[model samples]
Target: MSASVGGAVYAALAYLAWGLFPLYFKQIAQVPALEVILHRTLWSMVFVMAVLLVLRRWAWLGEVLRQPRLLARFGLSALLLSCNWLVYVWAVQQGQVLDASLGYFINPLVNVALGYLVLKERPRRLQWLAVGLAAVGVLWLALQTGHIPWVALVLALSFGFYGLMRKMASLGALEGLALETLLLAPLAAVALGLMSWQGRGALAQGEPGTIAWLLFAGPLTAIPLLLFAAGARRIQMTTLGLLQYISPSLQFMLGVWLYHEPMSGSRLAGFAFIWAALAVYSLDGLWQSRLRG
Candidate 1:
């Protein structure tokens, strides 16, 4: 019970940090999203590598590098992860935090479908219903807006695929993230160097405050993941699934109340459907877990 409480605290803090990510990204909104992502990749690599070195966690990395197959797999996961980060940062910069929030709200359902399609794992009847309801919510929003919610869809799908890849990965969260950053770091370094040479980079041209914020991306990207890894090991899957909603919930509130994004009656109705879907999904999972125990 004590372990569970501690895990809940860790998970909550992790989600809170993720929820507050928009505020951090907003501070660096002046930087091009691509450049921001490049810095994120580079700084994240440096920070995570430092941690791995301190922990003497170099063996798996060497073993992974030896296997061409593992490298290829991690390379693909890295690509997906990078794309997800780029899209998310772009969305926040575009004042589409609401859309980004919706994407995460839809993500668990996407994960359910991926499990069914990719892993041949069947979702229960209530889970299918939950997915169907989320689809309706998305469709309603798209129809009301008279445009595809491309931002939300891209965020959901990219992250869903990234999660699927990681689920199949052999490495722990820290190690896998380290490998992904290492794979992308070289290209990210080149991009940053070119931007600096052109005198167009935030690092070289921006205010000292801005530079500090950009550097903060290192811990901002990593600490929550570390917290999440710790919490996931200690908690039940059902508990973790419920905690996962906290980030998007905070984002949604920030978008609506803080950022004053448009939340029309139609939009609210659409979100209601998605929220209901999540309730059903969570409840069903709890029920199943209770049955197993």
Candidate 2:
């Protein structure tokens, strides 16, 4: 029981850190999103490699490197992850954090659909209902806004596919992320080098504060994920599922209250439908867990 409580706290902290990511990204808003992503990829590789070195976690990495098929799979996952990161940074910089939060809010539903389609896992009736409700909510938002929420959809789909790839990955979270960053670091370093040569790199010409924030990206990208991995290993899946909402909920609040993003009645209504769907999904998950227990 004590371990469970500790796990819950760890998970909460992880989600809270993720929720507050907009603030971090906002600090680097002056930097180009792609450049920021490049720096992130580069620094995160450095930090995670240090972690693996300290822990002597090299055996599994060698095994994975021996398998070309595994390397190719992680390479694709890395691309999807980078795409997700780029979109998220762009969204935050564009003052569309609310839309970004909406993407995460709809992510579980996307996961459900992905499971059904890709993994051939059948969701229960309540899960299907939840997915339908979310779709309707997304549709309503598109109709009311006179356009689709492409930012939200792209973030959702990219991250959803990233998650799918990770689910099939053999490495643990730390190792998987390390390998992904390793795959991406070369291209990222080249991009940064090109930017520097052209006198456009933030690290080369930006303010000291900006350079510090960019450097902080290493731990900023890695710590929460490590915390999440620790928590996930110790907690029940149902608890983890419910806790996942904390990040998006905080992001939504930050968007509306802190950032003062416009929240129209139509937008609120659309969010209301999504919130209702989440309620159904959460309740059903809890109920099913109780039955299984």
Candidate 3:
């Protein structure tokens, strides 16, 4: 297959994996979110470190450290990423996987807005229309639910910022994630220690099987990320933007069909509007990219 096709397939697999992640995270329902976050952070670090060594990226670490500005930027990305992880884990454990899915659905729009604001890259008229439609959907959902889905908002915002920072830093996938995990490791270690000292350690009390599954958390986090990185390098940002929908689509299906999350009429209407917006945006992106070609 062509590189573009190959990249698209990898992206699809990565996102599909991410879409089903709620299923995995929910399995460890017995553990506290914080402890789960800690395991995720620690194990992810171990996995990325191995990848880094195999890729001979240990030298890159020294280079990244020597550049204070890059290190600071990566550190900020890590902070945003940590927030995203914590909130997502909390949302899944609290039975708000659907809401988390909404966050991912809304994330692309947020990225568009961020692109305009942060990158000063103006969207075309169709892109603007897409943004407006998404906004209407979000507002309508809030009105019908009588509550803002703040968890979703937090997820979108944190992830959007993380993406923006990573784009700016221009670090490779494994390299960047290694730095991010390293940046967060000390704090996670402290939190884990505190939990242990307080005798509230969530990891200590889980069944051996449960804990063993938790070990998968690291690979679970890193693998899709690594896939995304590889795919990102080969595809245009616009293509990546469109591919993001694949994950949320799966999550939405899982929520409504399998998990039986409530789907009110208003919720359906709101999602329809958002879908319309995404359709416009995707078409516009493809059309414009074609024109450029």
Candidate 4:
């Protein structure tokens, strides 16, 4: 197969896996989200370390270790990643998967706004209009729901900042993730130890099957990421931008259909506005890409 086709397949598969993550997390729904996050961090570190070891990618680590500023920056990125994970998992476990999905749906626009505000990359007027529509959608959702959609907002913002940091990162995706997890491992270890000492640990109180699923989280987390990185390397930006909606779209369907989350007309209308914004933003991007070409 051609490179772009292969890349599209890889990217779609990655997004498909990510879209179905609610199923995976639901299997361990009995476990506390924080505990799940801890296990995820520990095992992700383990998994990535093994991958690096196999690839003999230790040189980067030594260079990274010498740079205190890099370490500090990654430390902050690690915090944002963990926060994103915690909020997302918590939302899923709490039956707020729709909110979680909406967060991701909003994430692209978040990236654009962040680019404009933080990176000083000027977005076109259409991009600004897209952001405005999303804001209005969010506001309408708040009015209808009687509260802010904090879960969606937190997930979007945390992940947007994390993506920003990664854009500035010196390492590749696997190595960056490895470093982020390395920074997080100690906290995970300490927290798990405390939980074990308090007799509240998953090993102590959870089922064997549940513990097994937790262990599987490592591969599950890393595989899609690897696929995405591989796909991204071979694909055009416009293709990647358009394909990015797959995960959230799947999540939204699963939320409303499988999980039976309430989808009121007002809620649907808010989502309509968001979708319209994305349509405008994506079409504009496509036009720009064509013009540049």
Candidate 5:
């Protein structure tokens, strides 16, 4: 019980940090989303290296380098993560945090589908119903708005795949993230250097505060993720699922209340359907968990 409580606290903190991510990204919105991703990649590598050094965790690198297959697998996961980051940062910068939030809200359903397809895990009946409802909501949004919610779709799909890849990875959360950032950092460094040399980089054009904020992206990115890893280890999946909503919920509120993104009734209604689907999914998962125990 104590462990569970501790996990809940860690998960809540992680979600709170994630929910507040828009506030951080918006501060650096002056930087192009791609550049933001690059800096994030580079700084994350630096931060994780520092962490590993402090923890005396260098042995894993030697073993990882001996496995070419592992490297290639992580390479794909890195690409997916970078794609997810790019779309999210772009959405936030483009004043579409609500759309980004919607993507995350839809992500669990995507995970359900992926599990059924890739892992042959049979979802409960309510899970299938939840997926159908989410699909209908997505379709309604696309039809009524006369534009598919691509922002949300990309975020959900990319992240769902990223999660799937991570689920198969042999490393722990911190180590997996460390490997990903390490693999991507060289390219990210080259790109940032080229951008700076071309006089278009954040370092070249931004104010002192902006440069600092950009640097802070490393720890900002890593910390909540570490908290999440810690929390997941100690809690029930049901508790973790409930906690995961906090981030997107915060993003949605920030978009609607703080940033004042236009929320038409049509969009609101679409969200309503997705929310209902989530309700059904969550309740079913919780009930199943209790029954199994």
Candidate 6:
């Protein structure tokens, strides 16, 4: 029980940090979202490499790289993660942070669906109901905006699928992330180089504050990842599922309450549907957990 509680604490802290990510990114509004992503990818690579060196994980890294099959899986994960990062940054910058929250709120349901479809896993009836409710929420958002929130959907799908791939790869968090970041670094460098050549690099013309804020991206991206690795091993997936809501919930509050984003009837209905779905999902998780015990 104590371990579980600690896991929850770790998860909560990670999610809270993630929830506040928009405000941090907002500080560098002068930077293009892709440029920000490039910095994140590049610096994350540097940070992870340093950690690996400190721990002397080069043997493990070399072993993993020698296994071309594993490298291929990690490469796919890197691509998907990159897409998720880029989309999220773009959404936050475009004043659609609330919609991004909605995407995450619906993510667990999507994960469940993927489990059934891709992994051939079976979900109980209540779980199916939860997925249906979440579907309704997506529909409501579509009705509200008179267009599908593709940015949100893409973000959710890419990230969710990335998680699935990571699971399949069966790599430890640090080792796996190090490789993923390494794979992405060259692309990020190219992009950053182009931005510099175009005279639009954030570090070039942005304020000292922006430079400092940009540097925070490396630690911000890495800390939660480290926490997630520790917490995931100690907690049940169901518990993790519940905890995943924290980030989006905080994002939603920041959007509606802090940023004063619009809260129209359609969006309200969408959020309502999502909450209902989560409640059902939570109940089902508890029931299943009890049954397993």
Q: Looking at model 1, which ten-residue stretch has the lowest summed lDDT?
A: 232-241
**Candidate lDDT (C-alpha), each:** 0.84, 0.84, 0.82, 0.84, 0.84, 0.81
Error of 6 at 260 (Å): 0.7
Per-residue accuracy of model 3 over 24-136 as CA lDDT, tens digit each = 98788888787888888888998889887787867677777888888888888888888898999898888787888889888878777877788776778998898899888
lDDT tens digits, residues 107-157, model 4? 767777666677676777887787788778888998999998899989888
* Model 6 error, position 287 (Å): 3.7
Clashes of each: 0, 0, 0, 0, 0, 0
Which of candidates 2 and 6 is the stronger one according to lDDT? 2
Cα lDDT tens digits, model 2, 183-229, are: 99999999899888988889679999999999999999888866766
TM-score of every candidate relative to the true structure = 0.90, 0.90, 0.90, 0.89, 0.91, 0.90
What are the runs in model 1 whose C-alpha is more than 4 Å off?
Answer: 1-13, 227-242, 289-293
Put down candidate 5 lDDT per residue, 22-77, tens digits, no spaces.
99998888889989999999999999999999999998999998999999999998
Worst ten-residue run, lDDT, model 6? 232-241
**TM-score of model 4 relative to the true fold?**
0.89
- The lDDT, on a scale of 0 to 1, for candidate 2 is 0.84
Better of 1 and 3 by lDDT: 1
Q: How would you encode candidate 6's per-residue C-alpha lDDT over 1-293 as one tens digit per residue?
A: 68888877877787788888888877777788888889999888888888888988787866787888888888998899888888888888888889889878877766776677786767789878888998998897898788888987897788778756755656777888888999889999898888778877876677888888877788789878667666665664445667778889989998888788899886798899989988998898888869978
Model 4 clashing residue pairs (backbone) = none
Give candidate 3's root-mean-square deviation (CA, Å): 2.3
TM-score of model 5 vs. true structure: 0.91
Q: Which has the better TM-score: candidate 4, or candidate 5?
A: 5
